[model samples]
Target: MLYPSNYVNKIIYRIKWVTQKNIEAVENKALKKEELKEKIRKNSSVNG
Candidate 1:
């Protein structure tokens, strides 16, 4: 089956956009985890 060039381009663009979004989400999650750990460390230091 043959597809139009524009249709193929659209699919490629969408895949790229979704992949970039996924990467950003993973990075954000890691950052949040680090922030949570830092907060716990600060609280423990203050209490101890």
Candidate 2:
């Protein structure tokens, strides 16, 4: 089997872009979780 260089490059570029997006999404979710936890802790301390 054979493929053109440009075609292979396009596929590699797309894969890299998709992975980068996924990594960013994961990071954002983690940050959101941390923010939520902090908010809950603050509220609890204020009440108590």
Candidate 3:
């Protein structure tokens, strides 16, 4: 039996795209948390 190569390539590409998007979302959440921590530290230093 023979199969079309393009169909396999398309599935691989979609899986890769979804994996990359998930990684980016996790990274963005981590970055936001770090920024919040820095802001809190600065505020506490000024008030103290």
> Which is the leading candidate under TM-score?
2
In candidate 3, list every pair of residues with a backbone clash: none
Q: Report the candidate with higher TM-score, 1 versus 3.
A: 1
- Per-residue lDDT, model 3, residue 36, is 100
Cα misplacement distance, residue 46 of candidate 2 (Å): 0.5
Against the hidden reference, what TM-scores do the models get?
Answer: 0.94, 0.96, 0.81
Clashes of each: 0, 0, 0
Task: Estimate the lDDT of model 1.
Answer: 1.00
Candidate lDDT (C-alpha), each: 1.00, 0.99, 0.97
Ranking by lDDT: 1, 2, 3
RMSD of every prediction? 0.6, 0.5, 1.8
What is the TM-score ranking, best to worst?
2, 1, 3
Off by over 4 Å in 2: none
Span of 10 residues, lowest total lDDT, candidate 1: 2-11
